[model samples]
Each structure stands twice: as C-alpha cells, then as structure tokens.
Target: MTSIVSLPIVIPLATAAGMLLVRRNILLQRVIGVVGSAALLAAAIKLLYVCYTEGIQVLQLGTWPAPFGISLVCDVFSGIMLVLAGIMSLTTSLYAVADIERRRTAFGFYSLLHILMMGICGAFLTGDLFNLYVWFEVMLIASFVLIALGGEKPQMEGAIKYVALNLIASMILVAAVGLVYGLTGSLNMADVAVHLRDVRQEGVVLGIAILFMAAFGIKAAVFPVFFWLPASYHTPPAAISAVFAGLLTKVGVYALIRTFTLIFTENPQLTHAALVVIAAATMLSGVLGAAVQMDFRRVLSFHIISQIGYMVLGLALFTPLAIAGAVFYILHHIIVKANLFFVSGVVHRLRGTYDLKKLGGLYATHVWLGVLFMIPAMSLAGIPPLSGFWAKLAIIRSGLEIEAYWVVGVALFVGLLTLYSMTKIWAEAFWKEPASPGPIGYASTSGLGWMVVPIVLLAAITVAIGLGAEPAFEVATKAGQELVNPQIYIDAVLGGRQ
Candidate 1:
C-alpha cells in the first residue's frame, strides 16, 4: 500500500507533462486529463481503503530516515482529502471539455490544471512543512495562470487581487518555515513536533504559531483576510471555479488542522481561543457578503467563505467530536459547493449571463436543472436529511457539548443567513421570468452533456451521503480520532526513527 501512496501525485505530474507535449491537440489533452484524473481518483480511493484497513501508510523518499529526507504520509485525513481532490479533479476535467473555449484549451489549460492537482495532492500527502510550502507555491503558480488564462479585463483584475494577497501569504509561510527550522532544527512535521516539545522558548514558539495562523489563515481565507476569494473566485471559468471551490481553500484549512493539532498543541488556551473567534467572524462576514450579491457566482463565492467558518469551527473546538464534524463538513462542502458552481456554469451557458436579475423561469422550463441546483443549494443551506444538515449538526452539536455558546450561536445564525442567500438565488434566477431568452448557438445539448454529467454525479453523491450518513460519519469519526491524537501520524512518518 505504501507503494501505491505516491500514485496520486505521480499521475497528475505525468499527465500534465503528457498534455504539455500535445498542447495543440485539444481532444488528446482532454482525454489525457480525464483519464489521469480518473486514475488519481482510483488511487485515492485505494489509499483511503488502505489507511482504514492497514493503518497509516508512509513512504520515505530514497529510503531516508525521518527529519532527514522527504516523506509522504497518508492517514485517514490525508486519504479523505485525496479522495475529495480526485472527485473535484475528475469533475472539473469533464466540465472543462465542453465549457472551456478552444483558445484557452490550446493555451495549456489542461496542463496547468493537472499541475494544480499535483500540488494539491502533494500538499495533502507531504509529511513536512517545507514541502508543504513548496506545494503551495506550485498551486499558486498554476492557479494564477488558470485564473488569468483568457486575459479578459475582469480575469486580469481578479487574478491580480488573488495573486497579490496570496503572494503575501506565501512570503509569510516561508518565513514561518525558516523560523521553525531555526528553532527546532527540523522541517519534518513529525520531527518538528517532537523537537518543539523540548524547546523552552514559549513566547517565540507562540509567535511562530501566530505567523503560521496568519499565513495559512490568508490561504484559507478566514476572517478579514478572505476578500481575495470573493474578488477572484467568480472571475474564472465555471470548471476552474468549481475545482477551486472544491479543493484550494480546503488545502489551507488542512494545513491549519495539521499544524494546530499535531505540532502546536501546547498553547490551546490562547491559540484555539483565537481560532474560535476567527471562525465566528469568518462565518458572519461570509454569509453577510452573500446576502447582497447580484451575481450567481459571486453569491456562491461569498458563501464559500461562510461555509469555511463551519469547518474551522470544528478545528477550533479541538475535541474529538469537533474534529469529526470538521472532517464531515469538509467532505460535504466540497461536493455541494463544486456542484453549485457547476450548476451556475450551466445557467450561464443557457442564459448568456450570471446576473441573477437577468435569469428566471429555469425551474419551470428546465425542471431537471432546477432539481439539480436545488439539491446542492438546499444542502448548502443545511436543509434537513441532506449532507449539509448532518455536517452542520455535528459541528453545532460539538460546540454545544463544550458550551461554546457564543460561537455556536453565531454558527446557527450564519446557517439561517446562508439559507436566505440560497433562497434569494432560487427566487431571482430560477423562479422569476426572464425578459429575454438565451443567445443563439447555445440551445442545443450537444456540448452540455459532458458538463451536466458531472453535476448529476456530484448531486447524486450529495444525496447518497445524506441517505447513508452512518457509514460516512463513521469514516469521519475515525479520521477525527486520528487528528485528535496525532501520535499515529507522527509514528507513521517517523517510522520509529526517534
């Protein structure tokens, strides 16, 4: 199983290289991208099964020992993330087949996308901080180009905001890495955790943690640092936006969870408390931003930030159940959010605009689209018996268990506001009558099949998750247990080398 651990990373890297060689052939590029993504998904599912059945799997590069050479580790958490990445990657590739213009396709869009997947998978699997930073840089380069691929004015403007803020985040992250190496004399996460236990410079350590929090926080788009997400996320093609929605920010959140739980556990009173506050603020701000948005994509973009708060709430509570909730929320949010963006893309194709005021009567005319949109939309809003309901319930229940009343109250309030935003989109974009029909040349379903297929599959996944919440929750619980007590991860990465 350890031999299979690197397949997720390798497949994308190899696939992207292959696509680059055939960049002129859009058909071949699409074929390579989709097949590679399918392979990655298969590898991810295998890894998840291995982690569950066998225990944590680790592969030390060049057979080097921990704290010395690179290590790729897959625990339940990483396995779960890899699975989500695979889903998003495959779906995005499918959507891009029909949605992306030939000009963009010829411009190495598929190559860059696979490169992005490599980075995301690397981030998930790496067992060290320096490599994590390297992966972040990899993602940043790919995403910047992906966002600005068309060279449109809006894309350029949005790309600038996204890249500028993220660059600051990158610099801060590398600086934090430097400090961690300087203090602990190690870059391996497991090794660093062990070293930090012996260090006595509490103040310096706390400062480093804060720096990490800021760096990953910006990457995660938490609280005041999240404006970049809303400004830029809606500017990309729907396929690109869907992939970003599903995986990018989640990487940042994953970093936070890994560091806070594994390496920075000593200062929970201050660090975790600060996290709780940030989570609440992030939740409120995001929903409020969504409440007034006029564009369909923009509204979803803002809600991404809002939903992020719930995931963080799971981390901030720092309990086993909370961690479980966070894991569950991550699982639910990625599929539902990605599908919403996919739905918006279909809407845009049909109506020639993302403006909510311009779209209407979709529910009456395109009844399947309406049902597809509502499945994810209602799930996002935490409607009962759906994925979001159970995800939010676990997080809220966790908060209530610890009497974190203030953040809990904020969470419930944010859910209500989230529903309002979803309702607003439904009323404006689906229920009301449009003044004009879609533009010519888009009435046929010739190209839409590839795009809608992913939406249908993702929506089905959402429904399945809702109906079979027990087994999914069990997976989340085991993942949460691993996170809460990270000794298993540490031992796997260290390989008894300590």
Candidate 2:
C-alpha cells in the first residue's frame, strides 16, 4: 500500500503533469481534473483518520534525514486544511465543468488549480521556512495566472494590482527569510524556532516579525492590505473566485499563526499586542465595508477580512482555547466562505447579474438555491446550530476568559454587522420581487443541480463539525499544543542530524 503521507503533494503534482500531457483533449482534461481532485479528497480523509489513530505523521522526502532534506509533517491543523482545500477544488471543478464556456481555457485553469492546491498543501505540511516561501510563490504565481486567465477588462485590471501588491509582499518575505537565515544560520522553521528562543536582539526580531506580518497580512487580506480583494474578487468567473475566496487568504492566516506560535514566541508582548490591534481593526473595518457594498460577491469578500479578525484575535489572546478557536474558525470559514461564493455563482448563472439591486424573487423561482444560499449565509452570520456560531462562540468566549473586553465587544459588534450584511444579500437577492415578470436567464429550474450539490455538501459538513465539536476541537487543541510547544516539530525536523 502506498503511504498516505506524501499523497497530498504527489497526487496534485502528478495530476497537473498528466493534464499538461493531455491538454488538447477537453474530455480527458475534465476527467483528469475531477479524478485528481477525488483522489486528493480520499487521501485527505485517510490522512485525517491516520492522524486520529496514529498521531502526527512526519515524512522526510527522498528518505533523507531531517533538516538536511525537505520534510512534510501532518497534524490536525494541516490535515484539516488539506481536506478543506480538496473540497473546494473538487466542487469548483464540477461547477467549472457546467459553467465554463471555453474548454481550452479550462485546461489551464484546472492545471493552475492543481498547482495551487499543491502549494497550499505543501505550505501547510512543510517544516522548513524556505520551503514554505517556495510554496507561497507557487500559490501566488498560480493565482495571478488564474485571476488573469479570463482576459476581461476587470480581470486584467484586478490581476495587475493583485500581482503588483503580492509581488511586493513576496519580496518582503524573501528579505525576512534572508534576515532570519543570517541571524540563526538555518532556513528550517523548527531550527529557527529553537535558535530564536535564546536570541536577545529585540529590535531585530521585531523588525523581522513585522516583515512577516506585512507579507502574510497582504496574502490573508487583512486591513490596510485588504483593498485589492473587494476591487478584484467580483471580476473573476464565479467558480474561480469561489476557490480563491475559500483557500487563498486562509493560507496566509495559517502561515501567520504557524510563525507566531513556533518561531516568534520570544517576543510575545510585542507580537501579541500588535496582532491584537490588527485583529480589532480588521474586524471593524471588514464588517463596516461589507455593510456598504451593494455587489453580492464584494460584500462576501469584505466579510472574509472581518471573519479573519476573529481568527487573529484568538492568536493574539495566545491561550490554548483561543488557538483552538482560531483553528476551528479557519475550518468553518473555509467551508462557509466557499459555499457562499458558490451560491453567488449559482445566482449569477440564473439571474445574469451579481448586482443585488437587480436581483430578487429567487426564492420563488429557485427554492432549493435559496435554501442553499441561506445555509451558508446564516452560518456566516453566526446563527446557532451551525458551525459559524460555534466558531464565533469559541473566539468570543476565549476573549472574555482572557479579559479582552474590547475584543469581545468588537467581535459581538462585528457579528451583528455580519448579520445585517447577510440579511441585505438575502432580501435583495431572494425575498424581493424580481424586476422582470418572466423568468431570468436559466429560469432557476435547470442546470443548477451541479451547483447546488457542492453547496449542500459543504453546508452539511459545517453542521456536522458544529454538532461534533468535541473531536474537532480536540484535534485543533492538539495541533495548538504542538505549535505552542515547538519541540516535537523542531526535533522532527532537525533532530539526529549534525
């Protein structure tokens, strides 16, 4: 039997290569894409089971010893992230098959999609800082191509700004890596973490930390670095945008959490305080921005920033429960955010416009689509009995436990604003009367099954996570413990070597 350890990266890379070979055959391309994603999903589920049964699994690639060759480590956090990325990619593949008109363009899209997944999975699993940076580039380059693939004016404009900003962020990240390498004489994350503990140059450490924050913050779409998201996200095809919304920013947040917990612990006071302020600003600014957006997708884009604040708040608190909450929130947000974007795609396919003012009466024509949209929207708004509610509850409860009164207040206020914004989308897109008496483009009666299947699956997973919170929370907590300790991770990466 093949080891489950390397499948995440291997499957995607092999599949991308296969697609490249068969790029001229449209049917084969789609088959390769769907099969690859399905294989990835299966592998992720198996990895999750392995993690549950056997604990964290670490694989040093090429059978090389740790800290000498590249290593991939899987724990609860990376395992769950792998599954989420797989789900998003799988669903988006189905939606693309049904929605994309240009078949040739789709081959490239799917190719990039697989490469992007490989990057995300590698970033999550890698134990080396330089490898993580390489994965980050993989993600950024693929995203730039994906965003610009459509060749529309809006996509072109958005891709330009996106490319420029992300390039700058990447450069800063490289500089940080160089600085850390020069300081510690190692590029391995665990090695750096161990060395960082004894270093006394607070000023230099703070500077490097800030560089990382700025770089990852841009990728994650946090405040002050978040302008590009709303302006460009709505321009892509719904399926492409859905995948990006679901997986890309979360990668950055994941990096931030990993670095802070593993390597930057020496300056907790400065690091935590800075993250706290950013978290508060991220929440307030994101929600308020969402509240004013009339475009359905744009509103959701802004909410991504707001919800990210909750995750970062958990990190800033730096408590066990808070870190677990952040993990849970990331899992919750991935599913809910992607499904919400998928719903937007469904609406666009049926109604021919994403403008909320021009959309209405969807509930009457497409009852099931309305229900699908409602599941994620309500979840995103943090309604009870859903995953989003528990995620928010975890963060807010952690905040209160730590006496972060202002963070708690800001979180609650953001929740209310989130609800308001969700309601606006619901009322404008579903409840009100349609502008035209006749049915819209697709009539909402046909070609929707493909779209709704994925949304329904994601929503079901959200509910399942909430209802089965104990195990998931346990996994998240374990992941947090590993991160907070850093010894096991560092040893796994660097131990038994000269």
Candidate 3:
C-alpha cells in the first residue's frame, strides 16, 4: 500500500531522468514519456482502489514515526486527485508527440513535463506543509520554463507574469508553513492539526490561515488573483496548456482543501465565509471575462477561472455533500477542460489563427471535429447528461441544502453565461463560414492521429462520467465524508500516536 502511494511520483521522476539521459533521441524520449505516464495512470487507479477498499494509506519516510519524519498520505480525496493527474499526464504526453515542435522536443520538453507531473503528484501526496511548499516550487520552476519554452514574444510575456505572481505565492506559502511549524512545533500536517488544538493564539491562527489562503488562492487563480492565468495559458503550446489547465491550479486548490479541512478547521464562520465570497466573485468575473474574448484559448482560459469557483464553492460550503461536489467538479473539469484545449489545438491546425472573427466553418468540413468540440463545450456549460452537468448539479444542490441561496443563484446565472460563451465559440469557429480556407491548407487525418487520439479518449471519459454520474458521485461522496471528518486522515497518518 505504501509502495502504491509513492509510485505516482516515482514513475514520473524516473521517466524524467530517463528522458534527460537520452536527450538526443526524441523517439526514445517520447516512448519513455508515454509508457511512463501510462504506468503512472495505472498506479493512480490502483492507489484509489486500495484507499476506497481499505482506508487511508500513509507512508512515513525512512521508517521514522509521525511528527518526526516525512509522510505521504493518500485518502480517498487525494487518491481521486492522483487519478485525475494520471489521466491528464498520460493524455498530454500523447498529444505532445505530434503537437510539440521538434525544437521543443530536443530541448528536453518530455523531461520538463514529467518533472511537472512529479511535482504535482508530490503536492497531492505529501502530508507535510513544508513538503507541499517544496512541491509548489518544483511545479513553479518546471511550469515557468514550460510556458516560456518556445521563447515567442507572447510566451515570454506570459511566462514573466506567471512566474512573478507564483514566486510571490511561493514566498507566502513558505512563510505560512514556517508559521505553522512555529506555532505547532510540527511541519507534519496531522501533527500540526493535533498541536493547533493546544495553541491559544486565536488571532495568530486566523491570520496564518488567511496568509495560507492568499498564497494558495493566487496559485489556484481565484477572484482578483486570476489575471495571470488567462494571460499565460493561451500563450503556450496546446499540449502544455492542456496539462496546465488540468493539473497546476488544481494543485493549489488541493492544498487549500487539505489545509482547511485538516489544519484550519477552526472558525469556519470567518474562514469559509471568505471562501464563499471569493468563489462567487471568481465565477462571475471569469465567465464575464470569457464572454468578451475573441481568442479561442483565452476564452477557455477564463472559463477555467470560472469553473474553479464551482470547486471552491464546494469546499466553502463545508459539508459532506458539498465536499463530494467539489471533488467531483475537480475531476470532471480536469477532463473536460483539457479536452477543450485539445480541440482548440486541432482547430489551430486547421485554421492558422485563434481569433474567432478570422476562424470559421469547422463543422462543414470536419464534422467529427465539431461533434468533439460540442461534447466538452456543452459539458463546460453544464448541460444535462454530460459530466459537467452532474458536477455543477452536485455543487449547486449542495449550496441549496445549506440554503446558500445568493451564491447558488450566482452559480446558476454563471451557468447560463457559460452557455453563451460556448455558443459564441461554436458559432464563430464551427457554424459560421470560414472567411477563407486554411492558409496552409487543412491537415490530413494521417497527420493528426496522435493529437486527436488523446482528445477522443478524454472526451470518452467525460461522457462516461456523465452517464455514470451515480457511481462517480458515490466515489466523490465517500471522499467528501472522509474530508468532512478529518480524523480518518489523521488516524491514517499518525496511527494513534497523536
């Protein structure tokens, strides 16, 4: 069980090292990336199954006991996150085979990608506040270079903004971790939770809580902190954007969920209330931003911010059902969001520009492509019988259960606005006539199988989740139960020592 807990991070770490060793052979690097990511996906699934059937699994490094050694913990929630990370890693690696340019490949793209995955997995799996901070830095370094990989003018501009904000977030994260250790004498999250109960500094506790929130909030791209995401995500290659869209911000959200539930459960009236406001504002602001964007990926990027609101709202509501909703939303959005980006890349392959005004008539010529776009686009809009619908339904319904009518209303309105944005993309990019043919002529099917295959697989998963919402929701609901009662996690990590 402990070995399974570590495999998600180990597989990627090893793959990245292998890729580096064979830097000159792009073919070998691609093979290692794809095979390694697939193994990661398998391990993630096995980890989830073990957690669900057995209970939370915890690994203390070097045989050291709790509060004295590093811990890797996997509860149902983290296991679900690990599975989503695996799916995205595998698909993105596949997509990049055909999508990333030769120059980027030769420049260690596969190595960087695996490193990013390793960081993300470590963040999800770590049970220490300081370890989480370390993973954040790892992700930051890798993603900074990834966004700036092409060295294009826009990529550089976006990378600068991305790194600048993240570095500040990183500083705050470290400070918050230091505060936790100072107050609790433990960097272990479970130990911190146990020790915090003995601390009498109410003012300092809440202050530290807010500091942590601000730090993770920036990385999660909520509310006013989200400007960097739209500016950066669109500038990268589609494969990079797909992985970033699926995993990076969610790592921040994962930290938020873990910290608040396990370490900062005190004063929910104040802490969770702040989250509610941030969630509503994030949703409204993101959709509004997306509504006006003419660029394909930019619109989708803003929608990512909006969709994050739904996930956060789940955490804010702070109930079992609500947490389940959040878990479900995070899983659903990862697949749907990445697929949407994949579709955008395919569109770019056919049409030279992301500008909506200049792009047109994909439906007439590439009927399958239009259908592919609609599945995720409609899912993003929360249409019924799709994955997004169940995800949004859970969140909205959870809000209603708690009578959070105002935020619930905001959520419903955001859904309507989301629908409008999807229609805008559909009308401009698919339904409307192309002002002219593709500048370089349309790509043949033979040239697109690598990219298209990943999109198809993700789309199929979205549909599966939608159609299988009950079982899917069951998984989320169980995970939510674990979160709503953090003792399950604490007990797993500490094994009664605390």
TM-scores, each model vs. reference: 0.98, 0.96, 0.99
Residue 340, candidate 3: Cα error in Å is 0.2
- Please provide, for model 3 over 99-207, each residue's C-alpha lDDT reduced to its tens digit, 9 standing for 90 to 100: 8978999999999999999999999999999999999899889999899997999999999999999999999989989988889889999989988988999999999
Sort by lDDT, top down from the best: 1, 3, 2
Candidate 2: deviation at residue 9, Å? Answer: 0.7
Over 1-498, each residue of candidate 1 has an lDDT whose tens digit, in order, gives 377988989999999999989978989999999999999999999999999888899998878888799999999999999999999999999999999989999999999999999999999999989999999999999999999999989999999999999999999999999999999999999999999999999999999999999999999999989999999999988999999988899999999999999999999999999999999999999999998899999999999999999998899999999999999999999999999999999988887788898788888778999999999999999998899999999999999999999899999999999999999999998998776766433544559999999999999999999999999999999999999887888887886678
Best by lDDT: 1
lDDT of 2 by residue, 180-260 (tens): 998888877877887877778879989999999999999888878989888888788888888888899999999999999
In terms of lDDT, model 3 sits at: 0.92
Instruction: Please identify which of the two predictions, 2 or 3, would achieve the higher lDDT against the true structure.
Output: 3
